[model samples]
Target: MSKPRRWLVAIAGAVVAAGLAVPPSAVAQADEPIQDPLPDPVPSSLGLTVAEFAQFPKTELTPPPPDPPPDLRLIRHARINHLGEVPDGSGRLYVPDLNGRVYLVENGTQHIYVDFKAQFPDFFSGRGLGSGSGFVTFHPDFKRNGKFYTVHTENGAGLTKPTTWPSHSANPFLHSIITEWTATDPSADTFSGTRRQVMRIAEARQVHAIQQIDFNPYARKGSRDYGVLYVASGDGGQGATTTEPQQLGNPYGKILRINPTGTNGTGGQFGIPSDNPFVGTPGALGEIYAIGMRDPHRFSWDRATGRMYLGHIGEHRIEAVYDVRAGDNYGWSEREGEFLYKRNDPQCSVYPLPPDDAQYGYDYPVAAFDHNPPPGHPLCSDSGHAISGGFVYRGSIAELRGKYVFTDLVDGRIFYTEASEMRRGRPAAQIHQFQVYANGQRTDFRQLVGDARVDLRFGQDARGELYLVAKANGKVYKVTGIKRFASCAVGHTRVTGSGGADSWSPVTPDKWQFRGDSVILAEAGEARPGPRRPFEYAVLDKGPAFTNARVDTKVRLDTPVEVTNRDVIVVFGYASDTEFYYAHVSTDNTIYPHNGIFAVNNADRLRIDDQWNEVMSRGAPPAITDTAWHDVSVTHCADTGEISVRVDGELLMTAVDHTFGAGRTGFGSFDNIGRARDFRATGTAA
Candidate 1:
């Protein structure tokens, strides 16, 4: 759904809400494995074996604490499109809607201290707000000058009009203008000011509108670098079709670093920094920081590392987070992530690998997922979406230290990666896997007040306090901790032999469930996977001497299936291919599945297959059997539209379905029929 126009302000006020605190610190002690609160339980539609779906070890040591409450709250939620932090650690969040409105949310207030739309009716009165403006940042000396800047998209004539381009063509003439404003009094709480035009660029129909703006923190006051503003513009919104590369003169798809004071400007006008990358480069905009960026929604520097993080929304198959370096070319029209995007395709460029040193030279995404998603896991889906960049946590929240938080605008899922774990030598660095949680459950948190749309942009102040900017509802929400019940450990097991038995014994007191021979020990690995390991499963009858829970057991598949069918239902072990894997149930054979399915289709093969072709011998299958024990879980929740499979703490498959339950539940070859000629189901349950 599209975002709303009005911004809403919903604060906790004086009331305390439930489920709002950080998970207990005990959960992260080295001796104990940290666990996030279990997601609201739901039923599963996919008919999976008890051993197919399991949980994995958390990549992050601990989850971040909930956001703190704001001191002041807005009357109604405001659709806050952009967020900016002042040098003094205060912030101003902006909301520009189609209603010809611009609301400014200042720090320390429950109301918009200044409504630009109300104050500047002549400029904003009738303009149909398109994509909202970038964040509003005060001049470096804003405390003294009360000067601030904003970049917004309005109609060419400041009012809505019919499109002049073909219906098939992307809309052009969407003008994104940057303006400067000065407060009448520096000491006043309200923005009583005179508006001045800084710069305006006509918007092309198909590419990115203006994204965000930031002043270099390192620049000294009144120095040449002062007033040096950085603006992240997209490739004119229509992917690559509506714009061209080497169009250096146009500010369509590049990061423009301009001195806002103009050449003959004053303290309010911007001044260009002499050291800007393109200062002397011919054919380049003198203010350009770096070019070839597409839909760079948010970019920020680490207070500690000075490294910049850019979240670039993908055109088709991937969404990437980039660690930007100075003067680096991030292949856009020529490439997306490591793959080549075909220039001719209106949808996006093709997946051709770029050369090593061309502007087309490929830059690796810190983290990326397939545009198309697997069932049960919605985070992988990108289809025509935007990605919001976030800050590197340098906050008092201990768990968030050195972590970068980002989110997808469509799914509302927040994720984080550890800076310490990023690969230093790779062209594309690895985003060390981490954990995430939903922000809040309030309807206000979900809806944009102005347009009633779901907005999930994240903002941070100088103190590193995080806030959520909602686009659909136009509200700013401070994420704070809510009290929650500690999650219990759950056990997963696979069983073999006629009477083989395996079970999970929880170190902590908890409830348990038996789904065939596999036991779901409520919170089994509470401390560590080891203290409870050396698990025993009784064998009543012998069928196949399957490699039972051994680390790194290579499973060789005789035949190849479609990559899309690489669905596996593993309970306690890892399985990448269709065959040659093992399973484990409870220590006893009480709750293990008798039959389960592991399908290695083209998609599965492509995932594990080093070679792209659909040949079994051409690729290697994942080693599912491990000497070191691990936990796996498969949960089906119909009410919430989720079916999930986890292994050794990592999530593998998650599908969404309306179905509630599948009565039959065992392990080994239930729905999967791939390479079954030599396949045999062995175990007491089978």
Candidate 2:
């Protein structure tokens, strides 16, 4: 027989064993008639007397209030498509966009100080210089040297020669390039001066080319003195791939720290810093501080902690933020987020490095989100294809103080984190406390819109104010604070039976049914995730009533599960109803069930006696005994359509049934009469 049918049989047997009447055997076994006498009925309630019910509380304790909301403002908006900030508090902004024109927004009045394409007319060639993929940064002593640098994609030099190759061989186009320039006057805004060629790498693909560049903020100016320039290169322009050897050594998929002067030390463009992590590492490039990055769109440093935060685009499932330390290797091409992606078990060779490998530093993201919106909460999802890292809020906004603010380019939702709550460890710890701010209320940070993209790169001024770069409209928005709203209270009450003070309603009474009573199911408990032992919920089910109608009690779980899928069931129904609902063969619950079942459903709504049809079931034999108290409701949803049943919130038999949805709705037929059925079908027996 199928599991569902077997479950029905078992439940029938239990009812008979509990001294309940059973119809004549519908199906006979081939062997001898093995029927046993009925057992004592188990009451739904564990036998609490009248005095005990009087002392029980009726309502749940309220949750603590959340932190107040802050006042929000929109300071200034810029028309730049993409933007980056200078590390030194110099109130200047660098913007580049689809126009292929790179402009410098300098000083206080949002002035376009330098135009790169205008200064280098021949180099630009009118093709608009492709996309302004990189930001401009000055040498440490810009006041004295007047030297600054930028990385961008320029029209490729055409080649006429043709060569033969296998048909399956790959042939890619080149569109990305990096270059450095110096201003003629140290104090002037124009870039009318000498153009020095630092180093240019070939872009075999157009997608992930020339992301962003920055000069080490800590680097100083002097011959052999200034720190190395840090260039964040995407892994080719394409998505995740390991076929290119250039990604490892050719400065393509890395954060390359190079000295503008050449390696020979004299007359070179840039000098490499002496403290470069890979200066002497075997078979590794000397300029590499860390390696193994894919589509590293943006990165930032916390001035207070010197911690580097990287926003990496994942191939699937997750968009992660990493806390990078020197020599750390962020797993890419082999792993995404904290899960392993690639492996060769025979010899156990992995591309980015194995999870257990200690030589390479595997940094963990400080915060992460799924690409798609989670079930129940749809507002947190962003439409952007990639995740962008923003600056740590060192700004003057009192509400944003000491928080890390970021946004998803696709959905344009703003999220922030409390600095103190972030985990601090070796590579970097994921931020579990990140929250989304909508209007003035804090809502679940999930997919808000199915289709909205915002290209959010960070923008900061000398004063530390933060700004966002919007890609769709090519604009920048300065983040201001928003005010918080008063907290609202939520409560629930259940009524059973009638005609005393008009306060009580009628409910189906089972074997040990009581006349009039109510119960409190939940009180104080830990809100945090992880194994919470001895968590308690209160039960109250005794009082005077005014009317007569069957009332049902229900409990719902709001928190998502992480570790063990177990919950403590606290119930206070009439003793008989509780016993029937807690029948060994009739309970089932699970997590992530196949049918998209959730806790919130129509049945969860409290009902008056007349409305009890929404959950009542007729025709099935009653499972409750008149004078017994029992505990029920231990259930779980399996990864599949199966439901594991337990009594009194404890494990029972796991029965597989395709008819039931993942969600449990109604709660009327207190006894086993409607046990193991899907939504209770209604009809009173004649």
Candidate 3:
């Protein structure tokens, strides 16, 4: 494979996103590792969520441009095809490209581990959806067994299945084959793996030959699901509007299960698991696990909570997500999502529920949003098409645990929903649109992603951290929790704050008191005050001195007055009280410079920018009078003489000046009362 490429290209704009807001405060506790830019929230009315998403660092996959389908918005095959994590504790991800290559992703870097083109040149030189290499899954005991499987299209060569498919199209050599390969040294970077043709299905068409193959991740060693490989096959509906989606005679449009090992029981190369639903059924193929679906593309087994969420791209109107089960028939062609797509048309016909609809023999999608969400749509169509299924968050993120994180490929609409109601096809999961904030601007999911046909996909590492695999962009992104500190990457430094002098360290400590880890500053005995005694700063001498970096803290303004010229302030970027930068977080935004940025120079203090526009400072969350401990951070980029301040993870100010460089960071209040703690600063040391 070519040299590793830097796959994740930073989105062109700053994204401000809203997300699960627990206030993300560690002020009350001492050892809560504070990772900042933590999710602050926007009103639920915005119908958007702020969550953390970062591009998977390092690994890159670059392929030559434009495969056959020219006008097709995205390269039908090149887009992030699929993301799978090896069961091995190495935290490696196997990214498969339909264009014939396997990427082993580890620690932000990807190495070409399997080169299909080089290994089997003539075998994969094909096009269209079903003509190339597709899904890949490691055997359950792959770590010890070194076994894995792949699905690809082959013509003429090891012809395992006959060409007498259910279609009239006399196409020879075009067959979809499932093959198993064994690695000599599974843990090595590049190993010579020998392959065996597992099973071959003669193709009728190309569009939906097959979709994905997933081995149950939650199954125990001796459980029924342990060694069973579940494969989703489409009806190969390339030409006709629909056919065979509901037909069990042919394995198309149905999810099939088989034992990759052992002898054949149902005429296929691989042995059929005796527990399969259709084994003794009259006309149904013994391998049929479930039926009545168009293309069962992306499916994931939630290891956290036992749930199977499958996204079946709709024919025209509705896209769906279903809690798949054995023997269940998910209606397709007949009904899309919960809608009655077609009653009876030659092109496509409906399989109505038993008249009273009492028996849901043909299951409806559990959680499906409208493609456009038209007027009567369940979600009433906000944004998105083509669903990207994700794993249930079982990681450290307390709020998102057990919540399924999924996205729409067309609009990049990210969402997290409860699984229980969704599994039984209850009212569409209360969809909460996820938002992304990067650098400065909040990003709308639609704008952050590429093409419409580009069905984005999601993956989870062993750690349960989710990742996005984009088809159009061919990039992988790791979804992480918010960080509370500024990396100061552009400023060339990244460091943390050092502990400071106790509130008793200063002489005029009127009402200021320190409790070892925090400080409380109140204007005790001094009543009805104006902005007197300009800067009453409490410096943390332990914070690393930096020429360019960010300082952060959780502050609670306790003053409740309606009108007061005084404000609580955090002073940083200074040599002493005479020269420093202070953020005056005040209760009222009615007056200019009242709640804004100011700098002290030669004993003269003034607003960094005369006009208090968004370029300088903005209102604080929950009216500064509210006693909630909101996060406040000030970042200085020495290279550009720029300074920015963010409150509760939202950028509120951007100002530039060459006044001060290196200094000790601290917090303070001027003629007002406030409590502050969890003081931290990370950036390059001066």
Candidate 4:
């Protein structure tokens, strides 16, 4: 397909009617409008103000001030739910919207990666969560092999192999297909990936189609989870009489673990992992990893503890999180979060009814809360509406470092729990609410999307920092302000004054001419890459090799911003120009990845360890190109390997790294014109 036609189909609303095998004529009619089999009702309640939901709970201990300040900033606006990351270092990101489009995000911008809506034009995309395109998972060796997979309901009869079990009926249920893709170039923005259908799953219902697709992160190259792909099989049908969750005859209401590469012992396109709990069982399916779960939609594994955390939606009453164990049964038709469940009762799935431990033997929830109750339990309905699984905090946030951070789908409320305390038998006290804010002020996520359904889903970057996605408004947010170390206290040593001829020395060749009060840096002749940097710069000469110190610079760009050159640059923790970190303030109308803290390896600039995903546009923080002298400061904590950037005396961003220690301070712009006026370097004599 031509690029123009690809973009046109991507922009136009398109959907595939799902079933067995699509007619050849149907592929030609791919641009038709999408109609859902069933429409989902709008969520109840308008919304709550930020103050109403935020809890300023008193605690005896806290992380030292300012790290991970409770604030979130919308980074990308898209209708994407599940997130996929390439193991490559550039932090290349991908997400699939239910509209059947997959987007690749680069430097806070979205590009069309693939359009499944056009490929499978005869697939079902109902108004429910399982509709449209399902999940995407990359191969463990995706970087080298360029292989990946995706799941969506389809009518590709030619693609499906005969099912050993009774797969689908001719009525409301459909066939959900999982397809593999091989990328020509694994790092490209365009979809040069070729598709190959892997498996066709028969669903008894439309809503609980194939939901999850993931390769185990903790599994070593030789371990059981290493090459295995874990898929969540919803009870292929809906309604109370649907007891497929109890009957392991089919892979519904259960977690299916498989080897995508048929090279294993079994004989199929994908082999069943030998270690699967049901592999040797007489009556159970070999692919069944665990049984008895309804809508076990969003679950994650903690790299720190290797514990599987799952957040499942309740029938109408209790929302629960489970510490998933292999072969464990989460009683859906039998019970909801340990409560006695009557499948046919009108209030069967409703909440607040206490559990009857004497009844069924089931794996209960680690934490659960009643959302809406009928008549009896006053304690019910206190928590948020639905569950959206999140990750354990292992990033720079000191206070929330070891806790589990997750949310509710309807109200967008946030909560955390001590990883150790949240066990199988723990009660409601194990869960705790955490106040969320935007730039240190309280803000509600529902309000972020104008009080609509925050169908809240969570994602983490290659750095393990978390991100939130709101499907209603197609928005993405970064949970920022996690401070690692406090500001470096500059002691008695002070080299203060305008960085002019006497105070500055040309680190590279001399593109900087020191005026009396300010240093003017401009391109010298045909600009060539310096030994340390690509542009000319100046360094502070009189220093004691300062270890922990603070340096500030007042920079002014030339009139009529030069769009071709690098932006303002300040280097610190500098052993040499080739071996230091710098604050590459965001540039306007530039193609380079600027406006973030960066490190230097072999004199080339690299991104720092950050709670990242910042959009470096004119709308971003610190408009440095306005020819105004903005105050920029870089603080280094040698003890902690952290660097914090402050623009105009306010905190801009904080990052952690220990590649280089205390050297000297320097300033200049890359192949551009800028003026450095108030250059002050203060610290204890190194």
Candidate 5:
């Protein structure tokens, strides 16, 4: 299979199927039809839900050396790539940082297992996207053999060092090397071992050298793939104009299968698996398993179904996930996510597929998303999106079961599709966005990271539980649970009781003014003699007692905006004047009693909301900074004792407790003048 014949076969197959009798000269003169490469926008409304993630107690690692170029896309304090439970079953997890250290973590403590950067002075990193310790994986029998492997990149060594493949780039910029290590004691926390080079290959450029390496976790001890290693190699950033992926002579743009313990490979470094796809093909590398990829960033095996999936980052148009199989050709430099990709076309790099595209024998994505940039940004640039590979959730979260969860590398938006719907030949599965929450308040990864680009990654443990790595912040989070709220049976209702107790009941009736359907806190509540508490608040006696309640109302601070102490409140779980919960929506949050969800139980109100800074005894920014009317909502769930407050539809704070249940709802002010109207309550009636 020569390179020229491969191109001719792909082109000729499409032309002959069209039944055209045109000569070669005429075909050359006619312009080739083009197609739009951008994928359809993801489904907006279907399958939308929130996933609750909790941070580990104390697992922050030391920052890596500063990136020389400081490119935000690749910059991070610690470029932590992945996390996996050690094969020895110590119930401990090992995390690999691209800057060259593998840390064994247990009970929020980190111990250095290996220091590749300190050992190998020639190691190169912090200069480019993937120019560091790439990945590490343990052999299935690691407990017995004490064997493991790793991948890393080098700069000057690539030009001078001998490589396993002779057909490498003449002017190589970097080289990716794989090394196998033998540990003296498998159960030890630190590594005391000797390593040997398994394989090395020159890279054309710096960006996409080699990303990940691993073994299929589901493989049995007697299976052929039990200890076999799979290395995902990229095109080294040269596939756009050159057919680097299509060529079969080199390991670039392909997945390679080899045996680390055997010595029958090139230069006697490792063994090329006899079952590899190109073992007998003339002029083809025996190690090639699958070819035709730009940057196969990550790959994983589904434990339940024994299926392999790969996440590939495209040049401009698509970010894809493939149902990978042995010998499959994922067309790159020719097709991008089922659409034609025009090489070196600066203005329009993607086009529609030809009618006879099937004859080319190119496989396509099973779940994919398009690059969506802001209004003025470039259409075909790296600013938009990249696909970060993820695992199927067979974890403890029942709602996330059977979904192939993944994320966008740039904006940190998590997404997923039905793993059962992902098949090789069908149209791509529909992608849906997953809502995220931390500390019980709704949030996105961008907000959680507090950065424009999240630089996010995913990892899974032996128990099938998932973790999220923020490369920008150097933190790991466990997917603790899922948040699913049941709807209230009472639905929605409004208050209008002609100034009677049926609509509103003020604790201190003399301090409040009531009209037809409105109540005003005419005077400020006096300071208590002992424990501070809201001396005046109105309870909605007309509504049924609710176990799970949602309160909606419009509030206006009667004082001037310059009065920084002014506030309005929404009360729920109102068993009595001394036992209730109130959302203190105030103009100033610098004090302990303002702008938070507080609970009173015969004592000073205690702050229980997630957003409160416990050290400072303060909360987030002011919820009511002006005198204008603002919509407020207070939600309470007696079953979980979860309460959250929203101002103008944005989440302000959240709290959880079991102090009270099946109570009334109301509105007022803590110690300032305010007015409330259009009050409503919806929930499961007691």
Candidate 6:
């Protein structure tokens, strides 16, 4: 057989070249060790700072309507699946609930735009998590065409009808149907028009069916892709038992591209684009654009590069995001992520790839994360299984620009990677997890939604701003603003009290004494009247006020090690003795205020670091445990509001806060004694 030209060097590319052909079955032998069991849970690097803002409240509809069958009931408070804006330039957005209602949102107010259950009595959204009113999208010319589309599932309603796509399962259970809706008034708030069936596919089960359908938002009116709709179809959880995904005749496990207005497809429902990848191939469906997928759940295109990205839910160990290209086959049953999926040997679901494995020509993901659940949890539990695809941020937020932000569907942990690094042939890009915020304080989706399983999804607007849609409380949060820090590579100078070019002044001169080059905290000062904060410290009175400050010094704890809370604090963003942020590197981390990064703003210090766990009694280890001097550095970026504290050249703790900016640096303690020397500071002089 001829080698597939679309194949490129990828995972295990160093093992062998693409020209060395070998039998596909030779890729995984029974005796091979399970070299790649699971991926590391923690990402090694850090990326852009991300924050989510609460945008809209819960929708009007509470699904199941207080009385429904057990199979129809939902565990979440609402089933808000996806959100998107209408292409008519109305600045209006639409959100679809799995309970069959699509609400039109204007600013913060929402009204029922259409109800699938009320319009089509046979519309089914029960018995499976994915079986519901799935998705909706508008034509690019929606301002003049008055046309749009939707995909939904039914409980075997179309079994008698001829399925447009072929399936190997004889006991097909659910039917995924697509329809075209024409609005009477293109500019109306509510949909009022005629409807027509586009196509239907019979599936073995309810899950892993059609979940997303959208038109290329970047396609111009005269472009060939202008009216084309891309349908993401899954294998209905049957890819492992059958080899149908490798066959060209099946639409399942494929992304089908078709012209909704043309009439050349099966059943005369839609037109298969002539330029489709498999149009003229023998026994292949003309509508297939790309094949070999288990669950092509969600996909989006980057506006800057016009490259498509799809999040494919894996079978057992991997969850991945693919850099999709036409005519490229993504290996599903045969491989997961970059490893071989052993079918006959269920004991080892994945194994290392053989030497000549690339000859089969399977495309791999550009970025992926593996399953890591609690001990004894089910292999593919919902704890962390699915990947919710997201777009490359061309949004108004400057910090998030050019980053492809996505999340885990179950855990709701947000992640992003540089769009430039998501190349197909080379190694996968490094993915970074970002913290979530609500109202102005640092928070997480679990805390905001009050559910361990966040059931998270994403939405993007015409202006490129993004939103976080949580099914837990039916609330939508917008990306109001982002904070990024500037580098401390400029205006660096040494600081000393010898009254030279750069010097310092003690806040409480009586409580501090200079011994050669070391500044000693001789005694603790009286408690402040307003808030409980650092009582004694010396300020950078000679240097210019700095933003994005970096301070490096050597500190020795003068207090005995037996003092549980003995600490040497580094302070920056200091507008006054009362307003400043500090990294309290203490001897004990069990206490809430000890060994944490904090911000004091005319009030008591608030713990801002992510490492502080009040219930778990855990935090960064003591930076200064004895009388020995320890090398410490504190870097704060005012642009991103990121503060990082390092001990002995290793990052110990970090926090994000914009409460104060462009302030002087200082060193002392919260209520203990310490001494500092070799003090140096660098930052943007404000």
Question: What value does the lDDT take at residue 502 in candidate 1?
Answer: 34
Model 5 has an lDDT value of 0.74
- Candidate RMSDs in order: 17.4, 21.1, 14.9, 23.2, 12.2, 8.5
Q: Candidate 3 on 68-109: residue-level lDDT in tens?
A: 534344344354467778886767788777766677877667
> Per-residue error at 639 for model 5, in Å?
14
Root-mean-square deviation of Cα positions for candidate 3 versus the true structure, in angstroms: 14.9
Error of 2 at 299 (Å): 1.2
- Judged by TM-score, which candidate is best? 6
Show where candidate 2 strays beyond 4 Å. Answer: 1-90, 104-111, 116-133, 158-172, 186-190, 218-227, 237-248, 261-267, 343-361, 373-384, 417-451, 485-686
Flag the better candidate by TM-score, 1 or 4.
1
Model 4 weakest lDDT span, ten residues long: 1-10
User: TM-score of model 3 relative to the true fold?
Assistant: 0.58
Query: What TM-scores do the predictions have?
Result: 0.59, 0.54, 0.58, 0.57, 0.67, 0.72
> Per-residue lDDT for 99-178 in model 5, tens only?
77787878656777888777776677755677788899999899999998989877664558888764356787777889
Model 1 TM-score relative to the real fold: 0.59
Best by lDDT: 6
Q: What's the lDDT for residue 175 in model 1?
A: 56
**Candidate 4 lDDT (Cα, whole model)?**
0.62
| Poorly placed runs, candidate 1 (over 4 Å) | 1-78, 88-109, 118-134, 156-172, 217-226, 262-269, 346-349, 354-364, 373-384, 421-453, 481-686
Per-candidate clashes come to 159, 83, 31, 23, 2, 4
For model 1, how does the per-residue alpha-carbon lDDT over 609-682 read when each residue is reduced to its tens digit?
11111321111122132223344444433233333444444443333333222111223212221111111222
Structural RMSD, model 5: 12.2
Residues forming the 10-long window of minimal summed lDDT in candidate 5: 15-24
lDDT string for model 2 (116-224, tens) is 4554432222222123334566676666566777765444342111211111116534334445666677565445777755655555554565566665453334543
Cα distance off (Å), candidate 3, residue 275:
1.4
Once superposed on the true structure, which residue ranges of model 6 sit more than 4 Å away at CA?
1-73, 156-158, 344-349, 485-632, 635-643, 646-686
lDDT of 2 at 571: 22
